[model samples]
Target: MTRRRSLALRLIVYLAIAQMGGMLLLVPITDFLISASGMAPGWEVAPDDWGEHRIYGLVAGSVTRAETGEAILEPSAALGAYLETNPQARYAAFDCSGVVLRGSSRELVDALGGLDRIRATTLKFKIPGDPDPRARGFLRRAPAASGACAIAAYSYRFAWDDLFAVAALFLTPHSAAVVAPAVLCALAIAWIVVRRGLAPLRSAAADVAAIDVNTLHRRIDVEEAPKEIAPFVEAVNDALTRLNAGMAAQRRFTANAAHELRTPIAIMRAHADNPDDAVFRRDMKRDIRRVQTIVEQLLATARFSMRDACADVDMDLGEAVLAMVADYTPLVIESGRRIEFEPPSEPTIVRADRWALECVVANLLDNALRAEPEGGVIEVRALSTAVVEVVDHGAGVPLAERDKIFEPFWRRDNKSNGTGLGLAISKTLAEQMGGSIGVDATSGGGATFRIGLRKSVVAPPIASFGRVEPQRAEGSVGARRGTA
Candidate 1:
């Protein structure tokens, strides 16, 4: 990725440039203000040559040749209208030999260095403000081809179009003197403001950079942040909070899984010392089964949460429960108990992942068996509403504990069986298949774990939801002792 430019630096640069540009442009305008305010005589008058240049303009336009080729003044013409009121008041033209020209008297010529100089340059004059009406002015000599020099004086004025003369007004040594030091100071101030204004953002960035798994709980101080970015900082802190929780849960899960596995291994190692004993063989088998159950529960939990792990398919609720009850019957009998199944009154179809559903049902059955008293009949039922219930006459779960039991590694007491992961694994698998499993008090006295299965579409053939089987009604289902 291309590196981003600094916004603070760019803003500071822009501000400094604007200040310098405005200052440079102000020089010509300041001259205009002074000259127009009649203060030109008091301060730097008329920007140094504007009045002298204007005097020469009148001399150039109004001077003309007489029939005898002599320089003469004609202020009454259209180009000389500015002098119409007081033509000779600011006008003078002198011939080379101190001879009085047509515009001004010999007394004015004496003031202009009469006859002593062959040619004359611009010379400053106060030119009385009467009829010319502005206090400050300048005089300049204009010579015609006929060898007559004319002197004219005028006050200054400012115009609107004078503003576009950026190069003429600003590209000067005088403008440079005012602009350089001021621009340097302006730039320095802009840099300082930018740095101080961005201090909070820099602090927030430093806080974020320091965070790792162990420090995720630390948050950026929102009080110090500007309102414009407070929401963004809060969002980052929220993400960190979630990351911290997930990491902590993962660590606890890993440690608990290890501890559960080690206990069975220790039991099996003791059993190996009495290999020939029947009790040792039995106990070894039981311990190995416990280890296998814990491993399977952990595997199911970790993998089922993956997006592609669920293969949802339409299955008949009665048929699936009947199958589960059949598989779990032998285990129930071996434990000196019985299992029963009840089919739905009508065909009930559900969408579920086959492997995930089996694991969930097996976990439910395993949990029931552990809680059931000897010779107790464990019941499996499929209601017409696409629900499966595993009923056991064990101590019913308390209301508060029901929600907690679905959490990983939560158990009622230290004597809890099967790693306390069966219900958690079942919850994970059911949710992944877009189904729900919950427990309530069984009637008469026990825990009733109910599964609300996903509604299945049996009409339109879905290639991924598995093949739909023909509905076959059966007699009241019985797995072992009693008809469910």
Candidate 2:
């Protein structure tokens, strides 16, 4: 059933404890300095040994200026009465001419260390005018309002306790004892201030807890946040904004996937009653394949989250492309289309997933086959700088459609036989592998899909390790794979 203290409360309590500890140590030091240092005002004011300040005030008050513009000693009735009642108080004033302005005798004033030289005696000294010849007294000299010198002397019984009482005016006896209650009051006020200060943050946390996919548009009000945490609130709001955009995109993707799946199902349903018809059956199979392609592309998109496609992969680009081309050679021939290969002169080392590399090439080739005219030669080239280009000899893609070709399910021709996800999947896979795919107009009226990957470092061939070219076709360049 214990409550945890907040950071602010903890800090306040710690400082208060430190202050109490300091006071605990300081009181003794001050006491020692007062007793042993002979009344130096290091931690306390100067010692009031024998009421020097009181006598000085009394003597200074009685001296006044006359209406005739001359220094005069006109003791007030109260001062005169005090002097009469208290026989122990002796004071004397002298004019600028060394004449006794207010004294019984000049000899007694000189004996008490007269105003000829003005000074204060910190300790008690022997003096006359008191009943005891060796009475302890304090002597002080002051200046009159009329530029005349004056002196005050008073005697009293000696007591160490009285001396300590006079020196201990800075801190009273219960000074340290008062800290506990003061700290408690301060802690209560601090707790209230801390709670009120964190009110906006608590509200923001509640708002954040309520957020979901549907309510992603809700934003934290920055004005309510304290200035110290305003930037943190703004950063959270920015993350929410990003999440909202991603959710919107995901919603669009889901709607499109549903619509795409619905089309093939509807097409298959329309052909259900005519299975004996050859054209309907062919169309049905094609729709089935289209559905399969959509499902597979969706699966491929899901796989993006399953594994790290950006993992380090090192292999030879030329040898990899050569092997991929060999595998797809039968498909090209079956479709009555010819394919050509042009590998790099040397080992084209590159960093890419071998399966993803082959998959991207397969997608590009599939896209190129659909776009290329019958019997058109599709060219696959692997450059030395870790680049692969798939050039198709067909009507080149228009500049306006090139940008949209890579978007998921985007199609220039809605009636085109193939799904539009090939390029999109290729682009996703390429980006995940730290590569990029783009399309440009081929030099001879076709579209060239370019795939660029990070070039991997490869060791140069030694004199004994010369490159051996494979003799497959005229102008076909291939080499042994080498990588660092």
Candidate 3:
């Protein structure tokens, strides 16, 4: 994955780059302005000479002076002599009245096509250099005499300092000292402002993180967020509101369905009990009982799934477990199974809904009984003040299937007699009460379903009713029990 940079840093980098580009562009702009204003080194203009002309007799006077042995030759002769002395002087000329009075070099005069090419305006000519040819020339009209225009042209090369000056305008020795600190300061200020501006967004994220099914009613503070983000916050709150309504409707449907089915199942059970045929009556009653169990499990699952299902009541863990085991003692006996419950001796209290805990214990015990073979001992032990384990000496759950056993309608064998929701409901109830349930292989054999719960620091009030223990019965069924 590509590493991500913060928005603040990215903004700063972009701004710095833009500033640098702008500064660099200034160099060409400055050069253009200088060139346009006739300030550049090779810039030249033509003078309209309508008065005394200096070049009218310059060539004739120069030849006469050379013959007379004069030190100061005429302008055209002086320029010609200078070119002869300096081979690097590529081009120099003196033009008078549409005629070339004197030429510094024949190459330049030929390139200009005699003197007719020289005009009143500046013109550039390409001249041959040692390595390569470059454009060079400056044209300017000298003072006129007697209606004759005198134009003097010279070739010049740009010096290194000229280029350096243009470059230095954008980047100098102090460029870093000025632009570096300024950009850094701008970035620092921008980061601080941007971070501060996003405070409301950070706060809104925290509030969003804290929201769950229980806090669905709480909405993001739209007013506190910036206007740019307010609309998004409002949309999220609207979605949450819709979600909460849908969840409420679903829960109501489930609860109502379960309640509606329970009454008919109970009535059916009553009718089946009174049937004349013993075989038919027994089969119908068993089927009705299974239906009733499913309905009850559905109701329990729906109840615990609700956000407000947990009741703010402290219940004794040992007492609750013992009571559920006692209630199921007769059922275990009828199934030709033995149950052993070891309740904690001390009062172990936990804050949870009493009904939810009872449902969890009852479901576990029922599962243990169903898994046990005929006359097999099912041990229910409460340990560590807040844990309970139900061990059944039957076929242990396969490792691959243990994770899926608590899912609704998931059964190891598809033909098993139960609705396959007992363990699912039990797991849901345990979690709702801030507890967890899992199954492990027993040391000897079979499977052990362990439940861990949160223990309450505050002890519950003592009830006036005395504790009830499990009673042993005759037959192939028996129970070893205790009470807190």
Candidate 3 has which clashing residue pairs, if any?
Answer: 52-144, 52-145, 52-146, 53-144, 53-145, 53-146
lDDT value, residue 354 of candidate 3: 85
Q: What is the TM-score of each candidate against the true structure?
A: 0.56, 0.58, 0.44
Candidate closest to the true structure, highest TM-score: 2
Give me candidate 3's TM-score against the actual structure: 0.44
Off by over 4 Å in 1: 1-199, 304-309, 460-477, 480-484
Q: lDDT at 304 for candidate 2?
A: 69
Point out the worst 10-residue segment of candidate 3 by lDDT: 46-55
Regions of candidate 3 where Cα sits further than 4 Å from its true position: 1-274, 279-285, 304-306, 459-484
Candidate 3 lDDT tens digits, 166-248: 45555755775667776778778877888898789889989999999888889889988899999989998999899898677
lDDT of each: 0.70, 0.69, 0.64
lDDT of 3 at 399: 96
RMSD of 3: 19.6
Q: What's the residue-level lDDT of 296 in candidate 3?
A: 84
- Per-residue lDDT tens digits of candidate 2, residues 153-233? 555332344433434432555764576677677677777887787888889999899998889999999998889889999
Error of 3 at 63 (Å): 84
lDDT of each residue in 332-402, candidate 1, tens digit only? 76677777777666567789988888888989998898988887778887876778999999998999898
Taking every candidate in turn, the Cα RMSD to the unseen true structure, in Å, is: 11.6, 16.4, 19.6
Query: Comparing 2 and 3 by TM-score, which wins?
Result: 2
